[model samples]
Target: MELLRTKNLTKVYQQGKHTVNALTDCNIRIEQGEFVAIMGPSGSGKSTLLHLLGALDKPTDGNVWFDGKDMYSLPAEELARIRRQEIGQVFQDFQLIPIMSAYENIITPVLLDKQKPEKEYVEALAERLQIKDRLHHFPAELSGGQKQRVAIARALLMQPKLILADEPTGNLDKESAEEVLNLFIQAVKEAGSTLIMITHDAAIAERAGRVLRIDNGRVTG
Candidate 1:
């Protein structure tokens, strides 16, 4: 079944007198439980497309249908709720709160939703990501690879229906990057979550079931 679809999606930004076409009339469909990778060079609007798909940002034109509803047509609160509960995002920057411990960071989503985190599940995720031992440490105390793992654990902690990851392995060394990517694939598969990952590495993109290429704000299979 189709989990997400975009129709004539476009985003534009105004920088002074210049207009930037971040994304342009991109139409794509993603099915449930599929692993998809998007590849593009710098300034290709890859992140812009991901942000639109994940509901992190609204497009300037067209529609995004997630599940069965037109996402942008919904009220802000409902959209926010969907974003919080059904969508999980792993940013390239590893956006963990410095003040929160690794474990605390992982469970932040649940806590934000006023729900209890399942201890067993969180522990299992941490173990799978090889970050169980670093749970008590603060983000400041962890290495770059460890921090990325913590971020992955946090994103998966919610068991969201859709996972949107942007260059998830961008900050790690080759060995660490491979380890994280493999662990990520296994975890996503085990959870039966639909994954849309952005990567610059062709080898990494090949790991996904399907590969989409974007250039100058346009997407092609």
Candidate 2:
């Protein structure tokens, strides 16, 4: 089943006097339980595409469908709710709350929605990702890999239909990066979550089931 579909997606920003198109009529579709990597160079539209698909932005001209529902058609509040409840985001900066413990950060989404985290599932996931012992620690106290693991844990907490990650391992060492990427791939597979990741690393992109090459606001190859 198609988890997400975008038709003629376009994003534009005014850079002083010139209007730059970050993404230009780019059509894409991601299937359920599929791991996809959107790869491009620094100026390409990979990040823009990810943001569009994740419901974080309004496209200049296009529509995003999430599980057969038009995401853009919903009210702002409803869209935000869907992003939190049905879509998980793993950001490049880790985005963990500085004051909260790792456990608190991971389950923050549940709290925001007035729902409880599934304790058993979370515990098992943390153990598998090798971050069980670091739960009480804050992001400031964790190693790079450990911090990313905590971020991943938070993304997995919702059992989301789609996981949208933007350079998830960009800040970690090679070994740590591999570990995080592997964990992401495994979690998406095991949890039946669809994944759409943006990366500039070819090695990391190769791990995805499908790799799309984007450049100059379009798929070049």
Candidate 3:
């Protein structure tokens, strides 16, 4: 089933007198439970598209549909609720709180919404990601791969309908990157969540069932 769709999506940025078209008339349909990879060079509007699709930003012209509801048409609080409950995001920088232990970071989202954490599931997820041993450790204390694993665990904890990954492996070494990717794929599958990832590596992109290429603010492939 189609979980998300965009129609005539466009984003334009104005810098003084110059107008930059970050994205133009882009249309995409993402179904539930599919792994999608978006590839593009730097400043190709790949991130722009991701942000719009994930509801992190609004499009200048067009509409976004999530499970048949017009996402952009919703009120601000409703959109924020969707972001917190329906979508999970993993960034290249790990984005874990340095002051919090791994365990605290993973459950932060749930706590934010005043919901009880599923302790068993969280523990199981941590084990699956091989971060069980590092729960008490802070982000600064863990290695790069461990930090990413923690981030993945956090994203999966919510069992979100969709997970958005932006350069998830950009900070890791070759071996660590591969390990993180493998863990991510398995975790998302176990959670029954859809994935849309942005990657510059062709090899990494190959792992996704569908590959969308973007350049000059348009889908090229």
- Residue 216 in candidate 1, Cα distance off native in Å: 0.8
Give all candidate RMSDs, comma-separated: 1.0, 1.2, 0.8
- The estimated TM-scores of all candidates read 0.97, 0.96, 0.98
Which residue pairs clash within candidate 3? Answer: none
lDDT of 1 by residue, 1-221 (tens): 99999999999998999999999999999999999999988999999999999899889999999998999999999999999889998988899999999999999999999999998988999999888989999999998889988998888888899999999998889998998899889998988899999999999988899998999999966
Q: By descending TM-score, how would the candidates be arranged?
A: 3, 1, 2
lDDT (Cα atoms) of all candidates against the true structure: 0.92, 0.89, 0.93
Runs in model 1 deviating more than 4 A are none
- Residue 130 in candidate 1, Cα distance off native in Å: 1.6
Candidate 3 TM-score, true structure as reference: 0.98
Candidate scoring better on TM-score of 1 and 3 = 3
The global Cα lDDT (0 to 1) of model 2 is 0.89
The regions of model 3 sitting more than 4 angstroms off are none
Deviation in Å, model 2, residue 43 alpha carbon? 1.7
- Between 2 and 3, whose TM-score is larger? 3
Clashes of each: 0, 0, 0
